[model samples]
Target: MRHLLLSTAALLAAALPVLAQEAATALPETIVTATRVPTALERVPASITIITRQQIEERGHATLAEALSAVPGLRLAPSGGPGQQASVFLRGNSSRSVLVLLDGVPLNDPSEANGAFNFGNDLLFDVERIEVLRGPASSLYGSAAVGGVVNLVTRRAASRPFAPYGELAGGTQGTVRGGLGATGTIGAFDYLASANGLRTDGFNATARRFRNTLNERDGLQAGALALRLGWTPMEGTRVEGTLRYRQNRFDLDSVPRDDPNSTGDDRRLMGQLRAETRLLDGLWTTGFRVAFTQDRRAYVNLPDARSTASTRDHYRGERLGFDWGNTLRLPGLGFATDGALNFGVTHAREEVFSLAGNTPFQTRVNAAQDSTAGHIALQYRLWNRMDVTAGLRHDAVGSFTGATTWRAGVVYHVPELGARLRASGGSGFNAPSLFQRFGTIGTAFRGNPNLRPERSLGYELGGELDLPLFGRPDFATLGATWFQSRVRDLIIFQGTSVANVDRANLQGVELTLAVRPAPWLSAELGWTITDATDARTRRPLPRRPEHVISATARLTPLPGLVIAPQLQFTGRSPEGPFASYRDDGTSFTTERRNKTGTLFNITASYVVREGITAFVEGRNLGNSRWEPVNGFQTPGRSLLVGTRFGF
Candidate 1:
């Protein structure tokens, strides 16, 4: 089997040569992130990828999970379809280490069962674009940003005129999806409203792998509504408010044995409001974001043991932030002084309730925490072709106290050298979640109030080259980055069959690149190598793989059309806990490693005519029989077709 896998990998590698005949174009302009401002992507000194709406539609992506499935160094674990509990991992980091943002609003539910929101069931119809920032972001985004950040930006009223658009798509896996949206300008006000729905009879979650006691078939139905009201009452001032609501019905299956029959449903809602004023050439902005989410589960058991047992988890969190940043042409410094000062506070409350017996296992846990932070950042154009930036931040979390993060970055552009050198270093911190504090599980586990926050010190160095052959325009940009980070007092779920686990330290590196040498073709490759281990034993972390890679190439045979081939690789990883399991089936015991897997996918799309287009996409084109988890084989192969028309 291993030999066959290797041979297939080789064959795929050999095919790339024939696929490289396409042409390339110059890099796209950067949209400012990290700071509440706009900046060129080339000036950020960080690794970021922006997945546009066109790409999402052309790829036949039904949800955010499907859209991100092909992004390098990103792992999306979907229990079923659009409405399932989805886990997102970046560079081998825990799902909790990644921060998600909706319309520049942080969507990480601090009150969530585990201090994170599942991205699997997140609907994506109203999103205009997605920006993925890789590496430590604590200096700007704090908390779960230790891994990276995903910001979903929504569409606004079209500048041209009021337009209405809609789409309908259905395919294998018992799926149906639809969306409707409208945007228009009314006097000095521009507004947009959109609503989308998706449903699917998803594949069986448990694939009879290993103990294979659970045989649960899952399904999902989700809907999202969004509204954006923009008030441009004046030229220098603009006020916008965005409201979004999402609901997901997810079925969760219990682990092997332990009565097996049980399921759960999850729901979430988020909102953001902001006001911006351009006073004296500086942009001043203030905003607040709020999120509420809940999870409910039911257990099925034998008639004799049929004591109605169930669990419900609820979370509520909010953030109030205000910032005043500005840009000034500094003649004395021989550069532009673009700077920003931001201050914000966050409050979160979490509660978990459960019923375990015929009567009720009524158990509830609650806590409220607050955090305050401030930051100042500056960007300078040292030369016509070079730019440098420096920033510092300070955050205070109740009980956890003061933590500071700072970074210095420089970008040197040499049109003649065909080189762009970029580098940045900073510090980051993740406060203990409410669950990690005063929370408690069943008779099996408990929380630790004495746990400390996790901290990390890291840096990244990389460069992009627009190489040229003779007098040609080069038409290609080659970029690569190498990064390393070390964390202290990492938070991890640790249990020795008796007590619950706490968070702990983690360390790792991420390497990524994008290259295009021709006008018709381009390729991107990314790999994440991590050593996320227990701070004490230094043993490898559970569920986190040591190596992961994603590669892809695009071919544009004609204008207004594109075809892309992609591959995703995940190295050997354990199927269950990393420790021994007792008779209760709960422990630190490690399950056998799930064999490495390489999946091939092809995506193609073309414009049919003005205001209309169609697309076709296929997954696992090789039809390889592989197991994402032991014994449980993934779908052999699947295909989806879709179309969209606008007026």
Candidate 2:
């Protein structure tokens, strides 16, 4: 591997400066899911990645796919371990093309069949950061944002009055977890609340060498709750409200038939109410939102023994949404310099219900859809170092036909040649799920109410540089990006209906580097290279994987202690374990190529002051059995110990 990336970039460039003080708390200088407002990340021309809650508490991240595993053009594809069933693929699209949110609701899964949204069973314990917006946002989030968008902001309020927090833990297949919270600022009322729970005794994704190992063991349970409130009645105006809930259950097996009576149960609830206002003096701003969501899932398989009659399934997806936005500050229609103008509108209504076989529940699905949208955008800054943006959107679902999307961007900077640049282009769409248009599974799988609604055209380009390494001066940084996309009617699953793949193409390349060089050192590295094809049978496009790498480091010698380490790499691609006696079972499948894996982890913490802390966590520490899909398998070496608190 190129001499292990040239000795891990010369050991993070010789540990970037040994040691020092003060430099964390800098990854979030402002970002609101890339362009829905609150910008600033160098004018945000797209391609973003932020995740900070003190780096998920110095890296012991639990869920949200382990805090988006290694970021940088994501590519998760779990099928086992840690509450199984996962999928996330950005640069290479498909995971129903990204889009997952909370704090703007919408968690995909309109009866699934590919509306996707599992990211391995969420749970970021009321996250306060996590805003990854990669590309194609459907001109401000309209239909599955097409390979990007993951919000999740929650957790705010705490500048005194009352602030509290907590967490507890235990580990290894008999684990236990916990959480509790409180936050405040009481004069004009500001608050936050939380609760969390977890349970485990897990380990079993079959694949005990596929030697038929299944002595039972596949467990997990979860719980969550949250609340938020705010008010400011006067001045620049503000009002807010939020609520969240979650429940989960797990234990399933059947990959190579490790069937111990499979199972799964899930639930989700969300709510929101918001209001904003700021006129004149603040350059005009307006906002309104009302949201609701509920998702329920169920699965069961008893009486196994190769299907001796016993099966069950159920799913429900619901939604009710509304939004209105505006922001204006146009410097009186003059040439540039911090000018802006943006406005948007949206509406929604969704419903989905489904049921399935073996005790007379026999294949069924009820569907409903209604959506509306409107958008407009523009931003400015010029002469002071370039920056521009533009947007447009139009959507109408339910009766099909009525879609339009657009996007534009620009950015530039050159402070004494430290350099920076960006570019963007867009269009996106995706619609056609409800079990791919009115589900009905008699012949096993069929539903194609005239399909059609999967379009795209994308672009991106980037650059960044900031020299001066060990001696200071912006202490090292480098970045690169390149992306491309093209698609039209690309939805597939043809064995008994469900089609569309007239064309397709996707491209990628991303590279990054960072080295804070002080304040107790920090390191980062990322790489990606993808190609996802199929433009007329060009093949290569199943679990998209053409190389990916990630590295991390954080050290804080002593003071209060901290240590973090991470690494990941994946290569070899192609996968399609079509299950069920293969084609004879009708889903028509074929593809193979899985071999390639590497993962390592580490975490350590200490801080017995300002609200206590103590921790240790290590996961998959090189137990490598490699199998992200084929036959499941992916669990090995675990350890955890925790503690956290705030006051």
Candidate 3:
């Protein structure tokens, strides 16, 4: 790992002379997650990554986890096969520290252990883009933003009167997928709607040596739907609404019984209504939004093939949220110009219910909580060459003392040098979840009502250089960031109850380079070095690799054709306390070191005509048997072929 890091540094040093001779250009695209406003990527004082729809298609990424794994400073840990539980860790932070949003609305399940968003079932259907903002962002997004935020933007109505699209695909493991969508604008109204379905006869989720290995495949089936509508009744005023729903069913391995008849179902529904208007000649922009979401999950277990009845467990969670916000273009102060102020108030209520059925330890539980928050932010351009942003927020959770968070950042650009320097610092917190506070399931687990919210303080500094190469219009970008965070009251499961019993400190460095030597070719390289430890025990955090790297190259060898190859490397790390169930009905914990592994994937796509395209993708070409989690097994090489058509 050290040698690899040195090699990467040397590569950057070798390119400096060529970069110094180049001219500056505009940033790649605009992003909204950094400040809740559309701003140029180079001007945002944060470590961020933007994945567009084209990128998604080019890579043939089917899940959010696949798409996000390539981003710098992010780690993904999948427990088993498709539809199984998965976790996303950013900068060595806990999965619960990262907040996920669908179309700007929070998607975390309040009934989950720590209010984490499970990416296992989050498909890419109708997703237009993804924006990942790294580091603490609670000053703007409130709870669960201790690590960062991942915002998914769905497809919107097209500018033309009407447009239709569809796709069909099939692959190994008896996989089949299909999707269709339409978008259009008509007079004062615009609308977009899409639907997708997928099914696969997946491989066994556990290793052959595991006691639960039934030698039976764990299959999955899923369906999703989305609809978005907008109306412009008058000038500078718009009303918009969105609806999304998804359902999935998958087979699982019962650890104790080693039965193949365990199955699980998950369903999610979301809706939002928003109104925005520009008053006072566009100087003041205001909006109000109301949103609701429901997440339901159920599991059934059949002890034997001849069993006529089954044991079941169910959980349901719902949230209702309201927000009103406005952004005002303020007059300049002294030498500063283009000043703006943003303020918003938010209120949300969450409820959860759980049932453990038909057993001696059966239990029924219900919990609810409400929160209100207010936030304000200010941005100003100073000296015509620097941008500064600051924000503060206060939240009052039910029956808990108020918590306050704040953030400030600066971006300084030297146009002539084609360089920029950025820095930011913030405080963040995660409120206890309903499941952790008041829910209980059978005799295996219990809740603690006195638990407190987890808190953190973090900061980052980075620099970017945009360089023109070879006297052509092609350019390259190189960036480096260093960050550190300290978290207090870290939550963990002790025996049968959850508690905040530890503290942690994490620090890391991320390096990224993107190059486009010509219109036909592009390449990217990203590397992350993390040092995460328990403040009390000084032990390395579990499942967090000290080094991670990813690289990709996209080549257009022929007209309307693209071939892309990608490589990902995860360095050796600690793994342990793995529970291994024995045939005697006993279980024990064991600790072991995980081996480093590398994966390779490739995709090729070609445009067949003006409105048609075809693609094929191959994943895990090396067929490595690496397990992200100690007891589970990962799939081997697989292939998929697909086609898309538009009208």
Candidate 4:
């Protein structure tokens, strides 16, 4: 795997000059996640990836996992099938260390194992774009950002009076999906509304390579609705609000047991209201936002098909958050003219409730916590060539000690060489989840209230170069980065209770290249090498692959036809004989290693008319039987066909 990645990097470097065209155009992509403000991508001083709506449509990506798999310095592990449990690891950090946001609202579930966001059932029907930041961002976002952040931006209203769109798709395994949406602007108000649904008969989630279960086929049924409204009351004043809801139900299989009468259901609701105004004749701007979210889950276990449920469990989680901020533009100081000051205050409250019945140990648990935070940031440009940014934040939790975080970054540009040098360093922390602090299920597992928050310090240095081909507007870009992080006070489980007992260190290098050789063709390649280990035991982290590579190419064969091929490679990595307890009450651990694996996918789309389009996709083309989990089976080959209409 190492040789393959190194060879691919060399090939991309050697082919850059030969593929250059005569275009010298600059790519001006605006991103807001890097610094909590809209900033040009080239000057952000951080590693970020933007997946646009056009790319999503062309690639036929239906879910967030599929769209994010092509990014560097990231890895995903799925239990099995669609709508199944999945975990994302960024830069070798724990799955719970990454923060997920929907239009600036946090989406983590307080009742989950570690308050992580499940991407399994998150569809992309009304999404406009996705931004992924690849490093710590605790200075801007409060907690759960020790690794990175993923922000999903929903589609906005169009300029026209009204526009409507719809799609229908079907595939193998009894799969069917559909969606409808409308967006438009009327007078001083703009609105967008959308709904989507999916149903599929999936394979058994616990099927293993050497053993097959007798359980019936697990299936999934899901639906979602989203609405957004905005009003422009005056020249510099605006009010906006959003509402989103989703529900999913799926069959389940008990680990190490063939249980066919088990099932689960999940539902989520989120809403936000925001207002913005400019003051002092456009010299200052201020904004305020409030958001609320709720998550509910239910599980049932039946001993027989004709018998009543043997056991049932219910869980609910809720969060309320408020934020207010202002930014002021300052006059030139010394050699810097583009100067600004930013400050913000935030407050959040979280609660979790759990109930169980028809079991040996029926129990109920309820917990809540609140936090308040304040932050300040500064930005300046020197000689119109160097950009600098710095920020500091302090948080006060209901019971824990106060925590503080800080970050600083710089970006320098060289016009003659068409290159930029950037570097950033920051501190991050993750507050303990409700489940870890107070949860208890029967007498099997217990939570400790004395657990401390996990903390980390990380830094990165990188550079980017843009090269024009044939003096035309076509160009190619190459970027490379080196990053390292050290974490302390890690939390883990001991016996039946959770505790802080581990520490870790992770370091990695990432290389990426994007080329548009001609108007009809474009390609991208990325490679990442990571070294993650336990700080105390000096052992490799479980499931942290040493090398990863991804590549994609899009071609326009005809006037309205597009074809794209994508490839992803995961290198051999270590797995665990995760700790487990037998029915007889004996505890033990297991160990193993996972083999290297690769996947290839292809998609094609054609515009049939002015407002109609058709598409087809093939996934897992090679029929690879690799397992992302230690004892689970991954899907083989599958195909889907779809059509879309716009008016």
Ranking by lDDT: 3, 4, 2, 1
Pick by lDDT: 1 or 2, better one? 2
Q: TM-score of model 3 relative to the true fold?
A: 0.94
Per-residue lDDT tens digits of candidate 2, residues 133-226? 8989988887989888999887889978899898898988888888898998878888899998888877877666654465477888988889
Better of 1 and 2 by TM-score: 1
Question: How many residue-pair clashes does candidate 3 contain?
Answer: 0
- Name the candidate that leads on TM-score: 3
Which window of 10 residues has the lowest lDDT sum in candidate 1?
A: 496-505
Show the lowest summed lDDT stretch of 10 residues, model 2.
17-26
CA lDDT of each candidate? 0.63, 0.80, 0.85, 0.84
Over 1-647, each residue of candidate 1 has an lDDT whose tens digit, in order, gives: 22432343345334433333332335657575654457777767777788888777765666787778766557666443355456776765677878887765676765554566567767678887889887777777767787788998887688755888777777777777788899988888898998888777655554444353444456667788888888888886777777777776645443333233344455455555666565555455544444443334433333224335444444344444443334343333545444344445444443444334332223234666666666667666765777777767777776656778877778876655556677887777777777667565555556677666677777776666654443445544555555556666666667712122333444444445565566887777867655555556666655566667888778888987889888888777654554333324444555556667888888887788887777777877886656554433455466767777777
Q: Per-prediction count of colliding residue pairs? A: 26, 0, 0, 14
Clashing pairs in 2: none
lDDT of 4 at 410: 95
Task: Report how far residue 441 has shifted in candidate 2, in Å.
Answer: 8.1
